[model samples]
Target: MPTIRPSGPADAAVLADIWRASVRATHDFLSEAHFTEIEALVADQYLPQAPLWVIEVDGSPAGFMGLSGAHVDALFIDPRRRAQGLGRSMIAHAARLEGKLTVDVNEQNPQAVGFYERMGFRQTGRSPQDDAGRPYPLLHMRQE
Candidate 1:
């Protein structure tokens, strides 16, 4: 059985490892440089602000997710665990939150764009680069 629960400070390192592995799993499609930066950013900046959840399958951490307001900050399932509905379960959990849920995916990540759409999120708008000048195409969506 798989269980979903809140992440604590103790889980940070494991969450970082998951983030790294998830990025590497999609390396064929994403820019290597971008993935490198993202891994470090997740370890340093994003993880602290977002609320994380650890997915344990039979008492072992199989994946993790991070939620921030209406946006899904991070959601990753080990490559070996893909297609088992963990991602769907995590997204569904986020959708059940108090407000609209959104996620900003790179325009280049078509798989994610389609996945979010399949999850019932609609394209609402776009956004410019942040203070760091990193161009992140925004996907504003909400659960129906």
Candidate 2:
């Protein structure tokens, strides 16, 4: 059985590792530089207002999910633990929250887009780069 529990700052290192590995494995379509940037962002922001849930399988942390407001800011399952329903469970948990839940995924990440759709999210729109100059096509999906 897998258990989902709140993660604190203490879990940052392990969570960072999971985030890196998961992105590298599933996001091969992304550029190496983009991947590195994604990993760095997660490591730098995986605390405080963005709450995370560590997924433990048989007493060991195997994955994590992060939440911000009603959005699932991040969700990653250890590559080795893929296809075991952990992602679905985590998304379902997030969907149960109040208000519409939203997530922004890169346009190239079809698997993630499909996963979110299966979790009942519908494409809302697209967000281009903001004034900060960070560039990436953001596909917005929302569920109410």
TM-score of 1: 0.81
lDDT by residue (1-144, candidate 1, tens digit) is: 688999877777777887777767754554678667767788887766567888988887778887767778677888778778888888877777746577766555666677788887887766665335666555555655
* Candidate 2 per-residue lDDT over residues 1-144, each given as its tens digit: 898899877888888888888888877776677667767766886443367888899987789887887878788988899889999888777767645688888767788888888878899998775223456567898874
All candidates: TM-score: 0.81, 0.85
The root-mean-square deviation over C-alpha atoms between each candidate and the true structure, in angstroms, is: 2.5, 2.3
Over 4 Å off, model 1: 27-30, 128-132
* Residue 123 shift from truth in candidate 1, angstroms: 0.7
| Candidate 1 lDDT score at position 124 | 76
| Cα lDDT, model 1, residue 46 | 72
Clashing pairs in 1: 70-102
Global Cα lDDT for candidate 1: 0.73
